[model samples]
Target: MDMKKRIYLELRNRTPSDVKELVLDNCRSNEGKLEGLTEEFKDLEFLSTINVGLTSVVNLPKLSKLKKLELSDNRISGGLEAFAEKCPNLTHLNLSGNKIKDLSTIEPLKKLETLKSLDLFNCEVTNLNDYRDNVFKLLPQLTYLDGYDKNDKEAPDSDAEAYEKGLDDDEDEDEVEEHDEETVPGDEDEEEGEEDEDEEGEEEEDDVSGEEEELNDDEDDVEEQQGLKRKREFDEEGEGDEDD
Candidate 1:
């Protein structure tokens, strides 16, 4: 039997019921693909935290007073919604270094309004667009995400936008501060690039405005043709009435 199974058997056989925290880091729950975790730790009523990092225990037993949970570096793909329903008082969650690719899987955690911090570092969902934005919007009560504070709104939009676009991650943030300490050449070239970008943006806007005007003119012409047709129909009806 693997270490995880041995440890689980130990929990079932020897562990007491009043155990508050069950931390089986590194998926040490057991081997041989144990099924139905709700039965394994069924007696741990006062269990507050379950730090089973690197374990493959996807389904957990119902713990009423559980608050903090750590399940990093495991094969936990989904089923966070059902898990959140059973553990409503959950505050701190660490699912970093897992196989979590879908950001939607954690949407269920929004129901736990008491949740203050969430850790999804080194996960595949970090590659999603506006990962931090969507997570914050989903869980407004969250004060921290991936170790960053939620109230840190000091970053300018240009920096945030570049970070979202993946252009800022590989670049060193200290580059500008280092450059500021000395008289750097080619500063004007950067300004010229910005000017060129602004000009291109203006041209694109002009093109869009021209397209909209042409569409409006086409609509006006169609309305004029319809008005003329209606007038002609009314005249024909009047003539028919006079002939009668």
Candidate 2:
């Protein structure tokens, strides 16, 4: 038998306690060939670069002891649901350059609370914010992501800048509302001032009308008194001429 088949058959007969790490990367075995081996070595602590064999590896039971899994540069697809269901103790997972397109594929990985690093660089991922938030929500212990430190100074500064921009937008909206309110009051005050001036002018005209009416009444009374005095004077002059 060839070397690859020899290693494969040898691993099949062995139990889980016999191996702590296994690397079958770049091997000549096809898809289903590694499934039997994974069942035989389900408790492996490290597995790496088993090209085109990740989806089959998910069938392995009791893989809770696995710590590091590297499936980079492979043809792995259908998200990380199978891997998360199979390996709950994974700490380092490198799925970079894979065909993972959605965040749901990696949601099952939240059960691996011990995961500290994850790599999804150059994948079909288009939304980083949703991925970062969902990953952070799931894996709080993750400190390194896509090759960058989580506590990097620039990251927090960029977050603060985004927050400040949001606050500035809110403040601008409030200012616009206040300006609108102020203009409404100004318009109301101008309208009220004009109304008050109109009322004052009406009162002044009414007062002028009352003064003219009183003057006309006084002139009529004076003319009636003058006419009465002239008639009495004429009567007194006729009586004096008759007496003489």
Candidate 3:
């Protein structure tokens, strides 16, 4: 469908001021131009019009709240000054797969004070020597060009990273909970069984030790009594001989 009808359908009965994001990718445009979009979309923060055959952005209405713009896969060559005037708060812009040739074509983007990322993959300008370094130097405000910094580090996908980390954290918690649930009671039961066995063994050893001690004491008492009787009998016989 044409860009106008596609945008209207995307609204789905919501007014333009209430819309925060709009996706118009792969839609037909009027001779490579934006149409039906107006300044009434004051609350729009993101707008994607990729592959819409747009050659310029001269018709973009003032979107002071816009932060990200996707105009990739279009015929846009230059006239990026329109972005600075219309989407003054833009931070991310994708112009990949366009007819952009050299540094001069994108030099106008320097006016975008808040622009941090620019994607120009498949554009002629990427073939230039030191293209990345030169672009970074030209647009000092930009932190990334085609998803990499001047240090050649890839951009961090915050949302995806957060989601994966969240899943990992949840998995770790589940593992801990499962281990506690399955192992704790079994460990307690094993410990209790070991204690019971030890107590029983100790009781049997005490009983045997007590019985042996009592038998030894009885034997010693009997020997002492027999010695006393013999001594007394001997003394009595000597006294009778003396008397005779």
Q: Report the C-alpha lDDT of model 3 over 159-188, residue by residue, as the tens digit.
A: 799999999999999999999998886798
**TM-scores, one per candidate:** 0.49, 0.51, 0.70
Model 1: clashing residue pairs?
4-29, 4-30, 5-30, 5-31, 26-53, 26-54, 27-54, 27-55
Using lDDT, give the best candidate's number: 3
Cα lDDT of model 2 by residue, 1-244, tens digit:
3325645665677665687877766554455334444455656898765454444445445677888887776666664666667787888888887778877777777777788788887778635666666666666788777766655422234558999999999999999999998788579889999999999999999999999999999999999999999999999999999999
Q: Top model by TM-score, which number?
A: 3
Which regions of candidate 3 deviate over 4 angstroms?
169-244
2 versus 3: better lDDT goes to = 3
User: Candidate 3 overall Cα lDDT vs. reference?
Assistant: 0.94
Q: After superposition, how far is residue 191 of candidate 3 from its true place, in Å?
A: 14
Better of 1 and 3 by lDDT: 3
Candidate 3 root-mean-square deviation in Å: 5.3
Off by over 4 Å in 1: 1-15, 27-58, 153-244
For model 2, the superposed segments whose C-alpha errors exceed 4 Å read: 1-16, 53-57, 126-134, 153-244
Worst 10 residues of 2 by lDDT: 150-159
Model 3: weakest 10-residue lDDT segment is 180-189
